[model samples]
Target: MNRQQKGWQQLFLFSLLPLFLAIFGASGWLWWNWAISPAQLNAAKPQQIQIPPGTATQQIGTKLEQAGLIRSKIAWDLLARYISSQKSNGGFQAGTYELSANQPLNEIAQTIWDGKVIQVSFTIPEGWSLRQMADYFQKEKGWFSSQDFIDAASQIDRKKYPWLPADIPFLEGFLFPETYQVTKERITPQAVVQLMLERFEKTALPVYQKSQNQELNQPKFTLKQWVTLASIVEKEAVVQKERPRIAGVFVSRLLKGMKLESDPTVEYAFGIRQTPDKPLTFAQVRKPSPYNTYATPGLPPTPIAAPALESLKAVLNPESTEYLFFVARYDGTHVFSRTLPEHEAAVVKIRRERQR
Candidate 1:
C-alpha cells in the first residue's frame, strides 16, 4: 500500500460520493412531487372525469393524469396497488367524479377507491304527478325509463312500507316532491321511488300524524281523503295566500253535501289540462267519471297529483270562510264568492276583461 495508491483510491471514492448524492437528491424530489404535491397549487375549479364501468385501475390513473387532477400516473398506480392490498374489496368505483387539480395524488386516489362518486340532483316540483315525474326522469337522459318509474310507483310493497293506505289505487300523491341527490349506482326506478316514499314518511306523514287528533273545526278526513283534498288545493290554488281560503271553500262544500265543482277535478277526470285559451268544455265537465267533482258529489277516487307541504297543511287547518265558489282570473289569483250568482258575475267580468 503506497501513499500514492491510497491517495488515488480516496479521490475515486470522493468523486463517486458526488454522483451518488446527485442521484439520491433527484429521486427524493421526484418521489415527493409525485406522492404529495398537487398538479396545480391554485386551481380554483374542478374537472368532471368519468370512469366507465369495468375501467381498469391503470386506465383510471391515466384519466386522472390526463384531466390534470394528479401529477403522475405511476404514482397513482403505486398508491392504488397499496390501497387495494389493504382492503378485501379493492377496486375503484365507476362513475363521474368532480376532481380538482389542487388535490394531492393520494387524496384523489382515496376518493375513487372509496366509491365517493359525484352525486347528481333532480327536482320534482310541487303538484307534479307520477306520470310527469316519470317523463322528467326519461327526459333527464340517463336516470331511468318512464315506464320503469311508473311500474315502480304502481307496484306498492305494503310490507316494506306499511304506512301506505292498503286500498290506495296508486302512489299518485304520496311521492313527496323535492330535490333529490343520488349517486350513479342509485339511479334505478325503485331506488328513486323508495327515496321519495321515505321522504314522505319523514316529512309529510309526520304532519298528518301530528294533526290526526287535533280538531280543526273541519270535516274529519282519512289519510287518503286528506291527501286527495290537498292535491286538489295544490292544483287549484295558484296564489300562495289563497290556499287556506280555497281549502275552506272546498271544506264548506263537502260539509254541505254539495258538489265541489272544482275545475281541476274535471281536468283530472279526463286526464286533460285546461289552458286559458281552452277552458273545460261543458261536455268534458259532464263526462261521468268518478273523479269529476262536477258530476260526483264526493271527493275523487285518488289524488289527482302530488301535493306540496303548504297545501297539505292548508287542508289540515283550513280557514273558516263562507265562500263556496271560486274562479281563476288567469292571473295567479282567484275570485271567491259565497253564491253561484256572484261567482257567475265574477266569471262574466273576468271573461269580458279577457275579451277586451
Candidate 2:
C-alpha cells in the first residue's frame, strides 16, 4: 500500500477505537442501571407512587426517576418503549403502586405492565362502636364520610340480613370487626356497612348454631342476647384467653338475675362523644339510660360495640364456672373472682398498685 493510504487507514483506526470504547461503556452503563436497584440498600420501606390515568410513559419515567425508584429515565423510557412495541396494551395502569428503591428496572416495568394496583386494607379493630367506626372512616384520608356511614348503618335493617336476629332493635352488634379491602372510587359508606354485616353473618351464624347444641341443657338465649353478651365480653376482656372466662361470669350473673353493672354499657349509653377512656366517675356510672347495664336488668337493648368472632364464640360457649365478678388490675389484665369479698379485695389491690 502507498504511504498516504497507510496514514489514512491509521487515522481511521484510531478514531474508530474511541468510538467503539464509547459504545461499549454506554452499553455497560445501561445494563448495570437496568439490572441493579436505584433505591438505597438500607431502605426499610417501599415508597408509594400514584400513577394517574392517562399518564404517558415519559411522565412515568420522570416520576420514577424523581422518586429515586429508577436509576435512569432514559433507560426506563427505552425499556417502556420496547415493551410497548412488543405487547398490545403494555402500559402502566392508573392506581397506587408500592415500589421499592432497590428493584430491577425490568421487574418494575413488568409490574407496571401487569396493572396490579395495590389493594389497600383497613381494619376495624375489635370492640369498636359504630360511632368510633364512623369517625375512623371520616378521619382517614379519602375515606367515606362519618355522618354518611352513621346514616347508612342506621337505615340498614338488621333483620333483613339472614345472619342477624329479626327482632333486634338496631345493627350495632352486627357490623363485625375485620380487615376490609378498600379499592379506589368503589367503596361507599353504605357499601362498607353492608359488607361488614354480611361478613358478620357469614362468620357468626355457624358458631351460634354450635352454641345452641352445646347449651341444650343450660338456659337457652336468643341470638340477640348472645350478641349482646358477646359485645360486653369484647369490651371487658383484654386478654384473648380471658374472653370465655369473662363471658362465663356475665352468663352466671344473668342466670342468677343479678345486675351486669358493666362499665362499657354505661359508656355506650353516654354516646361516643361523652364517653371517657379513663375510669368512669360515680355520676357517670349511676346515670340512667337504656344502655346502662348498671341501671337496666338483663342484657342491654342492643350490643354496645362490634364484637369479634372470638368474643361471639366466647359468649356462645363460655367456660362453665361459678365466677361472677372481675376487676381491672394496674396492668392490662383483669382479676376474676367468685365472691363479692374477692372482687372487693381485687379492687383494693388494683387501687393500691395505682397509688404505688
Candidate 3:
C-alpha cells in the first residue's frame, strides 16, 4: 500500500479504538452493577426511605446501598466522581429519601436533591373507638396493632377526662372524626389516636361550657352528664338533618323516665368487627350488660362511637320537641315518633318493609 494510505488507515484505527473501548467499558460497568452484581434489593413504588439531615456523601452512598437503591456504595460514588458531576462526595442527600432501583441513576439523584418524603393521612370516622382506629392503621397503613393503641391509651386515665364516661376505661367516643396529615416515619397508632382525642376535646369542651351555663340556670346538668347524653344522640342519628331531632328524642325519653332503647348502644357494645344491619334479638337485647338498654335504664357507660361535628351540634342545640322514639329506615335517614302509638305504628311499618 502507499505510505499516504497506510497513514490514513492508522489514524482511522486509533480513533475507532477509543470509541469502542468507551462503549465496551460503559456496558461492562452497567452490567456488572445492575445485573452481574450480588443479590440486589428491590424498591416498591411509594415506599419512602429516610435520609437524615446533614448526611455526609459517604453516608448517603452507604444508605443508598443499604436501601437497595444501588448495588454498591463505592460504585455509585465512583460513577458520580467519574462524570465530573458537581455533586461529588455523596452526591445525594439525606432526610427520609424515597428511591427505587428501577429508577435511573440521574432520576434517583434528583429525587434525593428534591428531598421527597412519604406522607400518610388518616381520616377517623365519627364515633370510631380508639381500638378500631388503631386497627385501621394496622390494616391500611401497616402502622401498628389495636392492642398497642389501647395499651397506650390505657395509660392515660379517662377519669382524668372530666367530660368522659364515668365508668369507662380509656378514650373512646372522645376521638373526634377528622382528616389528619401524618408522616410515614415517626407515625404510631398511639400518635394518631392521641391526635383524634385532642380534636375531640377541642370540639366537646365548648359544648361542656354551654351545659355549665344551663346548670347555672337550673342546676341539673353537669358537663360529664351532658357529654354522656350527647354521645348517645351522636350515634343514634345517622342523618345530619335529623341529629337535633334525635337528640330531642333522647332528651324527651330521659325526662319522661322511659328506657333509652338505643340499638346503636348494643351494636357499639359489639365493637368494630361485629356490627350488623339487623337488630338484636329479644334474648340478645335482654343480655345482662350495663350497655344493654333493655336491661339497664340509664345511658350506656360510654359513647358508642366517635361523634361527628353535626352530631355534637345536635347535642348542643337540641331541637325543642317531644320526640321519644326513633327507628332506622336503613336508607341513612330515620323514622322518628313522639307518642307510643305513633312509635308503634312506625315500628310496624319498618318491620313490614324489612320483611319485604
Candidate 4:
C-alpha cells in the first residue's frame, strides 16, 4: 500500500475514536440511570400498588414506571428477562406491593420476583362481637363490607371446621380475636373468617380440650356454655387481674340458678354499648330479648363477644369465691359483693363518686 493511503486510513480511524467514546459514555449513563440509580432518591413513603394476576413482565415494568417507582420500563423488561433466564421459575408475583421510588430497580425487581407481597394486618380486640369485627373490617381500606363478613361468618362449614359446635347459630365467640396477617389477594371476608376460625381451633380450642379431663370437680359446662361465660367475663373485667374474679361471680350465679344480670348482656340485646357517663336504663334492662340476662335465666343462645385466652382460662378455672354480685366502678375495676344489698350499695356509691 502507498504511504498516502495508509496515512488516510489512520486519520479516518482517529476521527472515529471520538464517536466510539461518545457511544460508550452514553451507554454507561443509560445503564446507571435505568438499572442502578433510584427514580427519586428523596422519596419519603412507599406506595401500595397492585399487580394483577397474569400480568406480563413488560406490563409490570410499565406500571412501575407509571407509579414513579422505576426510572425506565425498558430497563425493567431487560432485568426481568435476565432474571428469568438465570432462574428456573423466575417471574414477578401477583398481588399488592409496597414499592418506594427511593429503591433501586434491581431491588424492586427482586422483591416482585421473590413473591414478597405486602402483608395487610388486622386486629380484633378481645371481647369484640361479630358486629364489631365487621365494622372494623369495613373501616379498613380495601377490605370487604361489614355485611359480607357477617354473612360469611354466619355460614359455618362443619366439614371444614369439625371443632365448631354443631348448634352454633353463627360464629360469635368462636372467631378467635387476635392480630391476623394476610396478603391482598386473600383479603376477602370468607378468608378472614376462615383464618379466625382456624386460629380458634389452633389456640383457644386446644385449651378447652386440655382442660376437659382436668376440671373434674368444676361444673360440667359444655363448650358453648364455657365460651358464653368467658365472653361475659371478658366484657365485664376491664382490669386483667379481675378476669378470674368476674368469671367466679358468673359461675356462682349459674350454680345458684340466679339471673346473671350482666349489663353487657343487656347492651348486647339492644345492640348498644354503654359508657360510664350513660348507664343502662331501667327500660333498656326490662326490654324483652332472649339475650337480656336480667330478664332471662341461664346463658343467652350465643356468646355476646369473642373471649380472649385469659378470659377463656378464667372460665376453665374460676376463683373459689362465694361472691355472686358485682358493680363496675367505671374505672375498669369492679366492686364484688356477697349479697344483693351490698351490690346495690356499691352501685349507689359508684354513682355518687361519678357525680362528684
Q: Tell me, by TM-score, which candidate is best.
A: 4
Q: Quick one: ranking by lDDT, best first?
A: 4, 1, 2, 3
Q: Write the per-residue lDDT of candidate 1 for residues 53-130, one digit (tens) a residue.
A: 999999998887777776678888888888899999867889888878767666788888887898889999998988
Off by over 4 Å in 2: 1-118, 157-160, 213-215, 272-278
| Model 2 agreement with the true structure over 1-356: per-residue lDDT tens digits | 99999999999999899889999999886684663454457763687888888998899888888887886788887888888899975567777788886777887888888876677777899999988888898897458788888888887564576656666655788888999886553478877888888787778877788777773545677888888888999998989999988988888899999999998898889863332236788888888888888888888888888898999888777889988999876556889899999999988888777867
What residue runs in model 3 are displaced by over 4 Å at the alpha carbon? 1-47, 52-95, 99-116, 157-167, 210-223, 270-277
How well does candidate 4 match the true structure in TM-score terms?
Answer: 0.80
Q: What is the alpha-carbon lDDT for the whole of candidate 2?
A: 0.81
lDDT for each residue of candidate 4 in 243-273, tens digit (9 for 90 to 100):
9898888888988999999999999999888
Worst 10 residues of 4 by lDDT: 35-44
User: What is the Cα-based TM-score of model 2?
Assistant: 0.66
lDDT of 3: 0.68
lDDT tens readout by residue for model 3, 211-259 = 6566432225554456566667776766678888887787777777888
On a 0 to 1 TM-score scale, where does candidate 3 land against the true structure?
A: 0.66
